[model samples]
Target: MKKQLTAIFISLLFFQLSISAVEPMKPQEFKADIIIYGGTSAAITAAVQATRMKKTVIIVSPDRHLGGLSASGLGFTDTGNKGVIGGLAREFYHRVYLHYQDKQSWPWQQQTEYGNKGQGTPAIDGTDRTMWIFEPHVAEQIMEDFVKENTLKIYRDELLNRESGVLMKNGNILAITTLSGKKFIGKVFIDTTYEGDLMAAAKVSYHVGREANTTYGENWNGVQTLVFQHQHHFATKIDPYKIPGDKKSGLLAGISNETPSPNGTADDKLQAYCFRMCLTNVPENRVAFPKPDRYNLLDYELLVRVFNSGWKALFNKYDPLPNRKTDTNNHGPFSTDYIGMNYDYPEASYQRRKEIIAAHENYQKGLMYFMATDPRIPKDLQQQLNTWGLAKDEFKDNGNWPHQIYVREARRMIGAFVMSENEVLGKKEVPKPIGMGSYSLDSHHTQRYVTPEGYVQNEGDIGVKAPKPYGISYNAIVPKITECKNLLVPICISSSHIAYGSVRMEPVFMILGESAATAASLAIDNRTAVQEVNYNQLKTLLLKQKQTLNWNGKP
Candidate 1:
């Protein structure tokens, strides 16, 4: 009996060993020619392009949904010089047009009832066969369609282990391990995230906040204490203190106490971030604005003052989408932008970033709830605001709130070429052009500070238009050869704060992604660094792919 039992135990041990061997030891590994680390529009475009180029590609995304802000309620496209948006970027818009052409795409409103309102053009441009504006779900569906059509492999919700996950050999990234312990190995990697997480982990040199004007010879790179270009600032003087004229009462919650430096000097402050909320007035599909748990009435004390000062432009930025839904953005100074609250977001740890995002969401939600129900707000304005609420059909899985925040600017790589206001304003030439941008050089207010005179005022809102559509350099997307040879950053390209204002649009990101993938493919085929890719050959392929390198007189 003892011998039989011993033999049975040995058999059981061998069976367990066989099972373990079959299970494999290392974390689930994915091998591909190109590894894109983002779920932004840029990631989708890059994956699609690489797959079309017949290269094995994988998107190891940190987001559960794709298309980043484009599918995150920023349906009103910021298409600057729509003609400059070619390649897969243009195809995405065309697909949006195709989706809307079908009657079933519009459920909340009829096609004829929804006027063709867009950014200075018709939303549906029949001549160009593209639709610039769309709903959030439609944009996300298009991204999913791209994934299906291209048969691209995507591992969603896999965040990069920022501390020590990047396995490097001779400055080339061999593999990256996610926090989930999944390892993705690739020949080339694309950092398409808005925050430049992979780029930062790879030890690429980057700059956050504003650079001094002298850094890039840029007119709009640094502090702008009193410069107001758009109607986003205080229309009239408002008090900064909780108790007017009382020094000891302390400044209101949103007002900063420190004095700003001169206009052209540098500071670590970044432009404010807000949710590009999808709101609608359709009774059947409207979900009333829910008050956040930590709602503080005092947080919006300045907004109460704005209302008392007769500020009535709350709906100025309620940009309409395809349906009755609106892409509500920050309009007046105290509307949606939680200024002076996100200075540490660019390099924050994952938990800290979550706290920041939660803080912003809570602030914005309280702002809306206050507007809708507070007696401090004007009755007319309150009634008007009560009509609008979260769109039920959008972001259904996430409490009808956008899953992504508008990370306007973050860690910009100081790469092989740094785009400045000079290049954007046409004062300097751009070499090895990959794409073009014509959006106004714009930045939202960075701070709401109490003036020396003890009055509340905003600072760092800029909107200088680009003279023309300017070329974006390919060198801007590649890191220095000494840093990391295999990685390409399309979203956070090397640019000054002001230059990034124009290049930070979603369509432009998609354009850069396609161009970056093309370069990555060329580099793999040539067995060279991204910086050493033959530009002449890259330009040829980019043009062949129908990317608008130089703005011609065509869309």
Candidate 2:
């Protein structure tokens, strides 16, 4: 039997070789004018736009899934105005509208039961251009439609070539490789990831942490202890000390390695990351949380303590989208924001990243289990947790857990120009307006701490309202002309920490994605590098393509 199996393996290898020989290497093996390196909403739209302009484009997706946050559990888009979102971004919503047309599409809801009358939502044919509401599966189906319609080539689960792979000649990218050793070559590259990995690997300058207010002379750029919008946590100042006003209780778990400076000097600390889970009453798609390897009970002791402390808003953060489903998020202090644990995640290798992901899953799942099953948990909170389960219809592969965590912030590229708080507040004028972000200058929980007075405290969670719709410059998307002549438009936006808070929404990503593709196509057409592409020509093309270059600018 062993000899027979070995012979079969040998035959399979020979068959694969035969197939490879038939497909001989062309001079530009799988060459595209634009090669995007993500499966994000922004990446897909960018590639689709390039394709629309008759440019051959391919997406080398590191993730197994497509449509990063948009297809993930972020269904309730944080878009300020539907008018501000246009181009392929609006088309994506239109596709979502199309998905709900068929009765079979409603696996969770009957078509007749699901009403079509929408306010300000664009239907497939622009009949009901109202609020865009969809389930995870619906979004995925629509994203699949976009790809099929455009005939875009996508290589899924392909890890990128970080070290010696990106072959560059005179500031132009020739080709990039995957860890499995697949090559994807293209002309203009779009770095549409939340983490900006490809851009960093290509030796682009980027930043990981917050900058001081002094660095940019901006008001919002600092380690502010001020609780502005949601002042629920800081009703009273709590102390970090263990002995209640004593000097030495040490610190709680997950505090930063760096000293806490008030000036917000560039520390590696970032806002929290959590899996935006989709939950339902269905059981078949829900997988129980196994007792994870390296599962530590001490990691969840704090959560148990929080439950005992009378915090029972487990579902408080759930944002409803469509089909009677929810896009659930982290609610309160120490809920789902794996605080201070993902510091090394942005730059870690795949193996290390997986380990961290497991740890996070274990932490979050163990917290839920501890709350639901542990006798120490408050009776009411435990009862509430027992009422919830993973949604059957979503993430059929990963037990309905979101594939991409809501990585609120990561390595923001320090490009030709940094979009600081000044740009968002109209203090500094954006030279070339590619897109506008109108979402509140919002930030998720940043740190969990033991106060000096012996109580738990969560700091740096901000929800500042934007004064008005703000303009984002194209300069933030490109590296310094000296660093690389090519454009690396981050769908997650490129800015200082505070500025990124507003620019990090899914709709903003779509907007930025469309603009990036327009610029890429224009650069290719003009026979110039992205850095040298005339802004005036790019602007003309963007307006012609139905992008919102001119904002409504209303508060």
Candidate 3:
């Protein structure tokens, strides 16, 4: 009996020790000259530039991976003008080129067989020594190389305590604490998150959703009900009700019941989010699309209706990447984009955001599964979809699915200066140019609702071409001098909704990241606010760094 009791006591003691090992983390402190929040392409470039400038920087990332959408299946880059991309951004693509130069990089397909597939542009720019199109893993590897080469300090999986994280004094951030009880003190901070969490936490001014076209005197700033630039809209009229023509059957699974704001009006709606899936038709490297656990036939009723009505543009945007893989993005209406589902994501708590992200993942997975296996789909389309599957080697960590969701737009900062349509279209000359954007002003559909004509329609999809490469102002990055003196936002920049569509490219983010870091370092050295950095000196240093501040209207 005594032996038995002693054994139980020993087991209990061991269990207690195990519990202590998993106890809540105690607060720990770290100090750095510059602290960057968000593990994005912008964040990585910012840290790399700061390190090169001889400043101690730490990346307080709330992610396990470093790169954002760039490493997360956005391999088919959307560069409008390769000439405008320079500095660290161009270096990243050059590294991608070097990676492909090694013959061994071609695993599923030979380099010659893949040929040069890009969006009406050469994949490899010979003169620049940069390759714009690449595989998702290849992009991630390049970003990993940057972190490894710099030996930069990155605190992965450390989320900021949004409620009471930032400690500020006299218009300066003193320290920021993460939810895991890690506190980082820094002289200057940069927020490179797509969601602008750090900037929002610092009480910086920002705007979410779309602004009225009149607010900025921009043609593509708001509700674009009449604009149908892409073929993403429904090809024909499809009923949104669950029971086809019966309104009493209630609305379909994905269709919203709310009335859309008038054309060119502002609303709280945000663009749809999706996983830019990396898929492949190569048999050896393909993993069949798995039906999600929560798959419901009722959820995809609207899609079936569209298919039944003779929609055949489902595979339009399967953009080709290296290694026989494709960057499968949202193409037609009722596709991968989970419309009207992510409106609350910008300000959602971590746990809530996780739920939103998971929902998006499930939605996309179910979409692929339905396309491949659902008998309701046209037999020809089903057969074609069955030929493709998720790339087995890509996103291996998360069941062969992309780990990042495409946050097309989020909380845009309302800083000292906001880039508007006039500046983007070369109507107004921007002062103190730090970078340039040439991509067309593009905003994805924000809502899918029933139209007054008793048909389902998408709203808020806008695409307006910029006349030429335009300068991005330094003031667009830094907060108002009175709001925060030490912070810079690169990803969620201060811009009108229409202008952000042009400036939110990954290359532009990296360019702005480098410039922001350079400005931060100068500010720290000169003992001045980010807004007070001399533009002439900043411009000189940027030019010295080989950054392209203006386009000479040449390819």
- The lDDT values for all models are 0.92, 0.72, 0.91
lDDT of 3: 0.91
lDDT of 2 by residue, 1-555 (tens): 999999999999999999889986443356778989988888888887888788998998989888887788877667655667777777777667666665666565565554543323322234534347667777777778778988989989977867776877787777888777777777788988777878888788777877787877766665655454554353444444434466565544554434355745556677778777676543454444445446666666656556556666666766655555667777766677787777788888878988877778777776666666778777876676666666766788976677887778888887777888877776677889887777667676666665444466666677777666777888888887777766577654568888898888787787788788888888888888787778998888778877876667532
lDDT of 3 at 220: 81
lDDT of 1 by residue, 248-338 (tens): 9999998888999988999999999999999999999999999997999999888888888888888888999977999888988887889
RMSD of 1: 2.5
Model 2: residues with Cα > 4 Å off, grouped in runs: 1-28, 101-128, 226-228, 231-252, 255-259, 282-294, 553-555
Write the residue-wise lDDT of candidate 3 on 211-237 in tens digits: 998987877877788577876888688
Lowest-sum lDDT 10-residue window in model 2: 116-125
Off by over 4 Å in 3: 1-26
RMSD of each: 2.5, 4.9, 3.3
The worst-scoring run of ten residues by lDDT in candidate 3 lies at 117-126
